[model samples]
Target chain A: MRYFTTTVDLKDSELDHSIYVQCLQLRREVFISQMGWNLYQHMGCEFDQYDTPASVHVVALQNNAVLGCMRLLRTDNDLGNATYMILDAHLGRIPNLPSGIMDEQIQSQDTWEASRLAISSRVPTSERNAVLVDLLRTGMEYVATRGGTSLLGMMNPVFLRVFRRAGLRAYKFGRIADQRDGRLCVMKLDLEPGAAMVAA
Target chain B: MKHPIQEKFNKYGFVILAPGQVPSDAITTFSDEWKEVYFRNEFHKIDPVFEFAVRSTRNSNCTLLSEAQMTNELFEEARMFEADSNFVSVSHYGGNTMVFGGVNPELDPRATASIQHACQATHRIELLKNLDLLTDTQIDLMEMAEEGFLDKEIASEFGISLSAIAQRKQAICKAVGTDCFKSTLRLYTLQKWGGLVGEYT
Candidate 1:
């Protein structure tokens, strides 16, 4: 069972386009079908306005099968009324999430917001943690290599424990809100190039 | 474990090394200067300020080290690390004694209010930790539900009737005194951190 990770952009070649589609299908399966999050779906793929050309997709694959995936957007990006997921949620642009999710607005090239993190249920229970670690490690390294210093997202508090155990410096920055899907909190992970963390 | 309590104390020029299940688990913090020295030298043993903190009960221990107490080697060396002679500490005395404190030179009205806030936050974190209002099965049920398991899926996982799963979830919400099951799960996570206190996270 070989494991690897890859990053895709919409402007890339056709192969990257196919991988991105698989990522969206994986998101649909985990978020909309399983978790019941009211997200936009087209042809059995979950996505939102944040899925722009500027967005980068990090995918974890095992033996050519998509096991986990997440999306990254630089906080400085803007796409005609949308900034990033968390900031959009804070500004009341996203209806499902409660407004005022973050304390202040953030627009920095050195900061990126990660969202739509999903690990496939098809992966056996024993291997789920490994897949998640791979996906997160790749995502953090990708951000750090691109001069990103901080990664922000609204995530499950359970993942907080995962971050702590993995030696990633993460903390809940804002309030934890009870959403219909689960209890989510704004978590920030400070990324440093080649930092000490659990190996993928 | 890295709890938000440490971050709260850090905002006020205080440092809590790690708020564990016992009194000795704490280490001072002032933007990371005194932490190494405090832990390496075991300053808690000779520091009279820490002694006052250990003796405090249900109240904030605000004390200024006397000339005699300051003469101790801990205070003398700690001065180089920005440790002042005055300090304030708060505690939550339950099954375990957890202390959080920092040096504060100005005991003004805002500082007083901050002390009260620390006392309340400490009490609440501990209270939620020791609540134990839900059963083991109920706790598992909430966790599974939070993992995005549907009611029927949870019932199948637990090998119980769907109705029983619904009833247990309702019971969990009632036990945690919340109307929503997700809110109950939030409380459960807070309580779960108690067991995770000592472990590195």
Candidate 2:
């Protein structure tokens, strides 16, 4: 598996556009079609207000096809009327997430939020775990090398087991909220340079 | 593989919690509306089921919500929303608490035992909340312990005295709310694996 980062800007690169499209479609298939989440979609691609140029898209590819993807936004980022998604949710700006989900408000260059992680359902069951490990390792390295100390995000509680199996250490913090998608809890992962992968 | 506890208790509904003031991070199979009202109204503040679980010295609390309890203000308010009644509320409090409420009049003995095990597992992850308090050496000790290293082996590997190893292990246990090396290692593994990650398809 190969992983890379790109943005949604087609004009930025003629080469990245194809990969970005695959990433968006992967999200569309997972979030909207499979999980039945109500999201912004156009022409078989899923995106929302958070998908700005400042956002980094991490895509997992194998055999030249997108297998998984996630989006990363620095916690300190400010894009006009919005910050990051989790912070916005905690401030009551996002209606779907409860206001008190996070233990404390965070805005720091050393921290980033990883969101919209989706692996292709079509991947063979035996290979899904490898895809997840690669996707997370790639995302972690992307942030760790860029001076991030931690990664914070919301996830369904059951998904925690998969992370455990992958040998990634995640700590659950704050309250678990009943969101429209499912039950979710705030989690933090401390990062170390070149330490993204540990023997599973 | 499905969790054995989950499979055994598939017929029941419950909320499992770590050591926290509220059940905000509870693992529950309760209905959405039930949670909506329970959390929106901040009823956990007055929830007798939760109160019993939090205050009881015993490891387990098993009782049907009495007619008197059902008539109480909390349940009265809950009833207006068409919540289920004749409820049996069973909770097991370890480092974490598994509070199971169901309409069933009779609960299987095995189900309650499963709830207890779930609480234990839930608490194992909750122990990680204290990770920041542990020093680098203490953290390394924990990792080594999780890798199945014995106390003597770890002491030898770190070139520390056996007494020094014991001191650090005790500190680690106190920080994470475990009593011994075995449980502490369990907590470490749970923290390592019971975390959120990019979802697998």
Candidate 3:
């Protein structure tokens, strides 16, 4: 019931490693065992390569139990950029991708493009919604503080519904494809500076 | 025309018209219109029988189940062969009980009333306990507010007049000691959940 917002690294040492394992276990329970999502099962862990150096990990816990977790990757990362490029193939045409929160840090010389986000399904519904609200607020605040123009990403249609409910305008990208988890539609949200700042 | 079937529907939530008992033309026309809307919205996954149950019981002032209502039975049969099918196959009869009566079956009036009362009592109790920051009437008003029900709707639902409902709502707000309705609701929810606000780890 106690709530604390700290970066993943800050909680890393104090965190119960067993909770992390349970988080992964819960992910497997929902995604692999139940829904039969084939993408992460081969990874040995519920995590993927985008989880490495450039991702900001957020965790929600209650009484030392990791209830939920999400990963935010800077668009400049190798795996992160690849998401947008691959989306272009599904889209059948490329469109101008917007800059993400870490554009300045990642694309100091070149133009930055899109942020990648991955959210875990361990959290309860209400808490999950709250976490997403906080995520959008924090991301926008970070962009505003750094004088960034906008933010963009490729995300699943389900999560896109959440974003739209939170008052963000999202455009569906790419043709719907049948994944192991039913049909998925790619989507993008353009976070305007003023609006993003207010949201933050 | 004062149809006996319509009177039965008004008294009870549902009615069943036997085959050739009611005019099929009206039902067919209604069904066709509903199908257009359902398929247009990509809600074809919904079982047709269940749809008929809802439409006949909730929407229509008439109660009837025909042989064509057996389409839901076929849908169930078809879904059983699918690999990832967890369709809600049976009709829910309030609380957690599932009734086997699909197209046509005897209805239990007492069981239905008992279920309805139990659900209302449960909802009222939970709402009162959760809204500790507000009075019972205030909690009721808050629920109505959340639902965006009009004053008349709220009054009719609670068996009170429009003016009485508004006065009670205002008084409840005063008792809650908060000018902002949303903040009061949030605080009440927080208190109900052990007063741990925004403390997600």
Candidate 4:
């Protein structure tokens, strides 16, 4: 099953211990152990500043195992001031973004950013593919329900091609140079509210 | 390909397709080759990932298929694409399916929703691409309309008359084939004019 849990919605004390722990384990396996991303290297589970109060985590699970996960942060929350998108968090300066990249004023409330996308490598090969799609389904369903109109985040090149191929009205925002993960670029996926893609 | 998108597939190990290309029989793999799979092999119907992806379009909620679906031969073949590492993202919009995923190392679910929204919006744009949906002034006005800008607020932001705004909106709706400009905005919240170049600036 797939659903969302936010620091705002579910208290840390009330967390489903098994699922939450699995999320941390999955992060460790995907980000640290497998990918060698040092930033996520922690005491067997990866946690960061972005996992603050009011942060949303969309998780997918099957057969009692954590399938995949991602995090969404609402800038309107108090912690939002603590950590914004790649702009304030990594880049330190917002790009002279194209007009619809999102208004500086409106982004605070209506726009939320996604990060920490990870999938466990331990699942059996046959089930791995289906689990990945489950994660996306859960995450987007969460955003749509929250009244989100756009997603602003950073991605590397390989997945960027996937988004374009997937038909996301994805556009270039800017580039993040001098990062450990090569050069990361800014991307935006604009949403159409209540408009479904009908075959012409 | 754009840096961010490629990195997502590399980092997360998955990709999604636009609505127009979903139905194509060609499936891409981590090695960047489009393999010709007979899509009618019935695996898509029984595959939980495929079913959940299609269900994601109709409802704004994520649907998780039962664990039993992983045992199917078709999904088994797809999983074996990259040695059981990455899977493709197959998303549907309106009625069209944009089937893409199974690239990189391991596909993550967090990218799915963002990918689906992006795919649908971009697909919507492609459908309206020929219509010249927005004039220069109209585009400017629409940007103002974002972030809860009302007609009055947009008019004030653009320093234009409300009637002018109304007329511009009418033209946009007429051009884009939406019932009204509001609906067009709901479906085609476009930021870039050029269709998915898949490259970094």
Candidate 5:
């Protein structure tokens, strides 16, 4: 059996409650224990303010088992996606906040921030790239359908190389020290009229 | 809007390199010192900015990447050019596609506008190709899936065989490379109208 991707609305009530719990559990396994990001853990899952009604969760599944997942949030929405960009401000060091990209992103409502892309380390290496590519393409398709033109994310050097090599068009911008790792930078991928950057 | 390099920054530049071809455009405001360092370090191996420029075909509007978005190495090297922002875009005309890149000294509109209009207006024809397009039957199946319809419900509503619908759903899932039904529906919804959407004017 092959894998497929789907979106889970945090606000949807008719869905199986276990799937939501499974998402969180997978996130805890991949992001918390593996990636070591300092996210708030609830019931063994990781999440933060951006996990509101506005958040869009994309999951990769194999035989109904969660293989990987990622989240999307509109930058201009009240979901706190863009608001979280100002880490320095949150630390009372507003003086060091890099506001240049924010000033431009705020002026356009077509931008969304993608974060917390988690892939199970247990997934065989053969199936790993497919999961990541699927999640990314699904997210891009989602943004384009919403009349939005851009997708933003904080990517580490590893992801940066992967994206460029994947034939995805990403524009790297400001960098910040990762809370645990060394550093990561912001990237913007446009989903406008021409997405021809797909690898040939 | 009042950044010092606004005027020079808006003068965006572009060059067309086909797939698998490396960019050799020499027309740029930055000096050779940093460019050499950038290329020597194989920055292109991880340069998302350059990748973005070459991937998507855009209109004459300028794209802005703020300081917060810059990568550490890129930012450190860009500081040598005294650049604070990047104003870049790509476009297609006739059979030729080109990616444009330049500086935006600051966050000014006029500055970006200048860059957007800087492609020398060459190959002025709009591109005729479509990026990703889906079929009507696919769209219907996707919409039904999107509405939270069960496999049986979709079969009943469409007067189709349940196994056939199941097979279709399976195909859709494989095409999207995910096991999630919602993601398949989401992909279908996005591409139902054909993967191309106009600017949100």
Candidate 6:
């Protein structure tokens, strides 16, 4: 099987074309057309404004055809902050979990932040999940490189479980509420290096 | 003589050549070369598909089976793959059995109902027809529709200020005559596009 990967810096206008359009279409087809998520109203085609300049896009290809894609946004900016605030109110309060000596290493770091993530269903589950893991790891690494101590986000519980199982210190923040789809969890993960950050 | 299969394998990650297409001598040569490269392993499967357990690792725990089995497994798993005409078909497990190929649309009933309720509550369709009155550029700006992209992303994608996207969206709401942007537009669009004849007619 032939495989290829490309990172699309949303900052680059060269990649803003039909390929991105197709990716948006797939997102709509899965998240809207089929699933009936009313989150986005259809334009002439599937798209929305969040595909802006700061978003980092990654696409996977097989035999020259796009198989899957994802977008990552750095949350350093005011509006680009993580989903924690929206979810924090609903989730109530963050729980205190047991931490190891590694927690000290993380707490010593100065800054902590998070990001927003969106993924397409076009890629196979295995490949897509692997890509997600890679993206998360990359994001965490990027934060570490910047001397940040932690990463946080409002993630679906299922994904939170994946993060926890991978040895990341994923915690639920705020109060839990029954969403239309079920309970939504405000998840946080500390990214400082140490045994505690290692997957169990 | 070297087999053509070996030569193809060297060039392509995998191949599915039709039977009797290559000369016997070339096949032998290719097969020998393939064994050398692949350590005597035959290309038993070419991009075989597999349905995995929900919690399985992305790299492991998938069962390789025939296409039919894969489809059946996916059905059993309640997962869907998008089906496209141009997709190549292959199975994972050993055997020659074949089944439907391509990705099937996975629908979440709850999500659908949520969308329907939101659409009905808001009237989405009526808003779209009025979209023409907006500038061509404004119309082009509407494509980044996913909720995840947020306001800032919308602004950058359209090369407009965030305030501009918000204002245009507000204009869209006023044009469609609804207060809620998402729900109203969806319901309006659905009702407008439902019948055999166009809603405008």
- Cα RMSD (angstroms) for every candidate in the order listed: 17.7, 11.9, 15.1, 19.1, 20.1, 24.8
* Candidate 2 chain B: 10-residue stretch with minimal lDDT: B192-201
Query: Model 2 RMSD to the real structure?
Result: 11.9
Instruction: Tell me the fnat of candidate 2.
Output: 0.10
Please give, for residues A55-147, the per-residue lDDT of candidate 5 as tens digits: 888888777777777788776765333354433233333333333433243424677777767666555433455577688888888777666
DockQ for the candidate 3 complex?
Answer: 0.02
TM-score of 3: 0.39
Cα lDDT, model 5, residue A88: 25
lDDT of 2 by residue, A79-141 (tens): 888999888988889765677788898999988998887777555443555666566667777
The TM-score each candidate achieves on chain A is: 0.90, 0.85, 0.57, 0.71, 0.78, 0.60
List, residue by residue over A69-124, the lDDT tens digit for candidate 1.
88999999989888898988878888878777675678899889988877665654
Per-residue CA lDDT of model 6 for B66-151, tens digit only, reads 44644443234223222121121221111111111223233233343333233222222223334335443443333333223577
- Best-performing candidate as measured by TM-score: 1
Off by over 4 Å in 3: A9-26, A40-44, A79-127, A139-161, A174-180, A192-200, B1-201
Cα lDDT of model 4 by residue, A31-141, tens digit: 666545555556677887667657777676556566666677765655534556554544343332222222243345566777776665444333333443344444555
Model 3: per-residue Cα lDDT over A29-60, one tens digit each: 54455434454654334654454544444455
TM-score of chain B of 6: 0.29
Could you give me the TM-score of model 4 versus the true structure? 0.41
The lDDT per prediction is: 0.64, 0.63, 0.41, 0.50, 0.56, 0.40
Cα lDDT of model 1 by residue, B98-166, tens digit: 444545455454455566566546544443533355555665666566456788998997899999987
lDDT of 3 by residue, B1-201 (tens): 122222112121111222212212211112344434434644433544345444433221212334354355443443342211111112221111111111213334334444334323332232333243444455555545543567798789789898897677655544543334455544443322221112222
Query: Chain B TM-score for each model?
Result: 0.47, 0.52, 0.26, 0.42, 0.45, 0.29
Considering TM-score, where higher is better, how would the candidates rank from best to worst? 1, 2, 5, 4, 3, 6
Candidate 3 chain B, poorest ten consecutive residues by summed lDDT: B93-102
Return the lDDT, model 1, position A134: 74
